[model samples]
Target: MAETIFADRVLIGGRIQKDVLIEIDDGRIGEIRINTSGNSSAFRVPSSCLVIPGFVDIHCHGFGPDSFGAGFASARRATLAHRARGTTSLVAGLVSSDTEDTSRAIASLATLTGEGIIDGVFLEGPFISVARRGAHREGFVRPVDLGLLSHWLEQSKGTIRMVTLAPELSGALDAIRFLVREGVVAAIGHTDATYEETRSAIDAGASVATHLGNGMPSLFARQPGPLLALMESPKVSCELIADGRHVHPCLVRYFVNHAISGVPIFVSDCLGVEGEGKHIALVSDRLVEMDDGAVVFKDNGKLAGTALPLSGILKSSVTKAGIDLITAVSAATIGPARTIGLEDRGKIETGYRADLVLLNGTSLDVARVMRCGNWVVEKHEYE
Candidate 1:
């Protein structure tokens, strides 16, 4: 049966509107009516609530005790956790590993993508810089090899949507060109590239900067680095880890205010370790404590990915980062969707997929989540 949801405030066309009714049929939005008497059978959200499109996380490794290398079963559990937290779509991010292990992991995840359990795979390593590699094993970081990349791409069966590489590495420009030809996004990250090398990659079709500030060298006053190159590029979109730890809130605001190509994307880059949810002794030899709603590395007080949920990121974007609500929401929704080329979702519109979340208007807490017109997380249940 078709369902109708009436909300007093609905995010539409990048802004909130009043008295909106969204009709869902066959897992897609059928129509959107404004300023009309809602159907008698329509389900009405509280007048104090706001409805928005479900978040699209283009770069996420795992969720809730499940990491990508743990296979399909673990991936499914992670997907569930993210979905409950209002991430309706995400790419399964894979870190650097041996060729056989990487291929196996991608093959395992391809099944989940086929089943719609996850969106696709993001290969975040093997072709990265050893000097800048954060948590990835140093031994596994290698030069870009087109043959190996093609093999892994085949193993993914067209589900490998993005690959992160260091623009300064040997054959890196050629790799970016190959990825572009293969319809995959080549992202520059885990790099120690000079500005000219970074620009070369962008010219060769590198379109994204992976976890912008974390994996690259810090910027110097006299010499601009990859960060500046990524920021200045007209065609590149930068991914930011908004856990309030990976990148400072001030830089997040600066990027949002200055980014010219498009809105910066907020990615979890989570390694599936939620400090409160799972008890892991070592996340890269660093202890974690669920501190102030974020996962903090106890030793040096850095972030080990984020225990902060995507919804929490949205809240932080508004409350702490001082970003406007609509632009913050766009960073998590349409911005990442555009980065990954997913057009059917990331927006609330007629004929779009019925993936949405309802939030407590004041707190911005996720109260309900609907994916593909099916209620996944409902604060209130109907008999």
Candidate 2:
């Protein structure tokens, strides 16, 4: 099957180009002709529209891989919810859990990965920090346990693509080395690491700073914590959660623009508790709720995670954080795809997957979503 799109503005090569024609053959991009040059009949659109690559959410916890009562059916529903909101590639997130529970979640998510239900699995740690484990249950958070991690990787059948661990934990450097050796990403998150400790981890192989400004200390002038260390490395990837509540809007802007020498990408970090009226769930035997536009722990009133999907996150990123559409879209799309080594999607270039999202010019809202050369959502063209 062949389809052609005549887009007023197409995001390509990290910038926007005007009046373009994109050709698709068998779900992959065939050619991108600039300026159209008389190609007027192919999926016509006005100048008031913008087409960008479909989002790649490397971190979202929405009923995702390893939550309570998570099954293939429920997980698929969560994945589809992200898809409906312009996310073409999603990596289901698993909070820190017991070894047995983690193994089970990995098994289920690994099967989904094999079936193409999700892009991959990100285990956000049984090896993180207990003190900085925001919303991550404390009892299950432990020191870097390479034995348990090895078991998970084997059980995953090569499906666990990323793991989050604190650099300050005992045996963490060795764990980072092992993870890198096995082709898994070693991410620094939920840590109380000083700048020196963080530098050591990065030197050992930690390439990603998981949710950079969150799950870590504030960048105090005297202390100058891990935030600076992580941002100093050009090879690291900083994951930013642009949800209005997680990190302040001002900080979000700063982080997006100036905080990282490394690449900055956006993640939803959704907790899957977003629902009508009110929703409640048990997280590690603690009560968590989503209501009235907030997801929080019932006991201590601490934020659990965002209630929005990637679409809402993007909107907040642009409107609340005062980010331009071009930068915001790139951060959400190509930046994250490349961060996770998914080079085939997140671009409108030849030989890339035809995963694109059409957005309203004025509102920047998702108008239509195309995945694998098929329209997965109802047609809502920019009119």
Candidate 3:
């Protein structure tokens, strides 16, 4: 069945326009007509709503009670949780674990990607640096092994869309080249690489800086680090965790303003533990309430992963980081889509997929979410 949505203000071509009519047919956008002069017969969205492209999160681990490494049922719960929060597309991120466990997780997530439940999978490690492993298990961290990577890629059945590795490690540049040749995005991260080592990887085909500042060394006054190298690389896209807890607001603002790619991609990197309403007793003999909605960690305060959703990221970008609404939306939407070579679904235009989120004009709360022309969430209907 064909349907039309009359949006009072629709974001298209990087600008918001009023009185827009979007026609949907068979799960794609059929036509977009702008400046419709007061035609109220169609299904009208309120004027206080802003219709924009659905968010694309290229680096999210899990949500709710589910995580990628847990299996298919947990992956489904995680995907659904994110989708309900307005992320229409997601890349399931898997952290470093035992080789067999990582392979199993990849195979399980591949099934969901094949079914279109998730966009793809991001292998966020065994090929990372042990010195900057963050929450990854050190026992699982290893040197870049081409045979192992090839085996994992085969197990994924071509659903592995991106891989994060340290560029300074032995054979890391060769791994990046192989990943690029196989049409997967090779990202630089989890490293203590110097400026020249980072540059070498970027020259070899690494084009994304995974969670730019985290899991990496900080900048020195005399010697530049991977972060600066990423900022200066024209071909690289920097992924930022905008949950306010991982990074400070001032640095976020600087990256948004001065990144060579013009706009940084925002990723949730959430571990699916937010809003669980449980109190955790840490090894330090302190109790922290999960209701605080912060990222989890072990007793030593070593960072695990975030608890933020994409919606909360948008709010933080605007409220805490001082980014404009449109720019923040672009970071969450088209920026990540472009980074991973997904060109079809991140924009509101003719011939694009009909994936959209309707937000309250003032509060920017997600009022409705539509994926492939089907309404997945309609807040007013529930109310």
Cα lDDT tens digits, model 1, 201-304, are 99999999998898898889977889889988879988988766677888888888765464598887867653333444355445666565555667777655
Model 2 TM-score (2 dp): 0.92
Model 3 sits at a Cα RMSD from the real structure of: 3.0
| Number of the predicted model whose TM-score against the real structure is largest | 1
lDDT at 354, model 1:
96
**Candidate 1 TM-score versus the reference:** 0.94
Which digits, one per residue and each the tens of the lDDT, describe model 2 over residues 91-183? 889988777777787888898899987888999987888889998878888877788889889998988889999998899999999999999
Q: Is candidate 2 or candidate 3 better by lDDT?
A: 3
- Give Cα-based local distance difference scores for all models: 0.84, 0.82, 0.84
Q: What is the lDDT ranking, best to worst? A: 1, 3, 2
Q: Return the lDDT, model 1, position 160.
A: 96
lDDT of 3 by residue, 1-383 (tens): 87889988999998999899888889999878999854555678888899999999999888755688889998988888788779999999998888888888998899999999999999998899999998777788999999999999888999999999999999999999999999999999999999999999999999999998999999899878898998888888898887666778888888887655534989988775433344553211233334334555645555566666787788887888898899889999999999988889789988888899998889988888899889885332111
Candidate 2's displacement at residue 366, Å, is 1.0
Model 1, C-alpha of 195: deviation from truth (Å)? 0.6
Clashing pairs in 2: none
